[model samples]
Target: MNMSTKPENKFSEYLGNDEQGNMRLRLGTKFAAIYVEKGKDIYKETSKGLVKVTLEELVSKPWIRENFERERAFQRSKALAVGLQSSHIPLRERRAYKKRMGWVGAH
Candidate 1:
């Protein structure tokens, strides 16, 4: 897409600085707000309360750090793949497509 047609990216929007200079990121609606302590430890605020995230897990590309932001983007035709999949897809249609594609059945 052209620069003029490109939508804004909110991935960094969630990254904010607290008065104490802590890093904060608000994940999806299902997930809780994530906070970084001294840029070393990561914490997630959940219904069960604050939970610590291991550095190993956080450093993993497919988890909270990279994957979280990549998977949450909604822009120019990208939303069709990321944001609207659940709402746009009907179970019956999905099953039919899967059956036609010879996938056997839903997992």
Candidate 2:
């Protein structure tokens, strides 16, 4: 008997494009991977299956919580950098602000 087999693609379904237009795929049955133009692709797993989810829903998984925390910290740091770069802020005051924010020597 000749058995015909089909190749299985792990990223089986093209769910849709994210807001940035990067393609999102369903990885197997339980997870989704979003391809980004820059940096690493983001992977999210959900028990809700193929249903579309918001950013909060995607990052709410316990296994990926650390990634969410890291993202939050990065956003905070970016905001601090922008605030410290204001022309009106003196270098001395910026240094004081950094120290008060516990960011001394963190750069």
Model 2: per-residue Cα lDDT over 22-103, one tens digit each: 4444444334453222124354444544334446754664334343445446656987889868778799987898988989
Model 1 lDDT tens row, 6-104: 223222335655798765666543334555544555677667876888767676633466533443353335756655575778778878988889898
- Name the regions of candidate 1 deviating beyond 4 angstroms: 1-15, 29-32, 47-49, 59-63, 67-107
lDDT, model 1: 0.57
TM-score: which candidate is best? 1
Give the worst 10-residue stretch by lDDT in candidate 2: 34-43
| RMSD after Cα superposition, model 2 | 13.1
Q: All models: lDDT?
A: 0.57, 0.51
Candidate 1: worst-modelled 10 consecutive residues by lDDT: 4-13
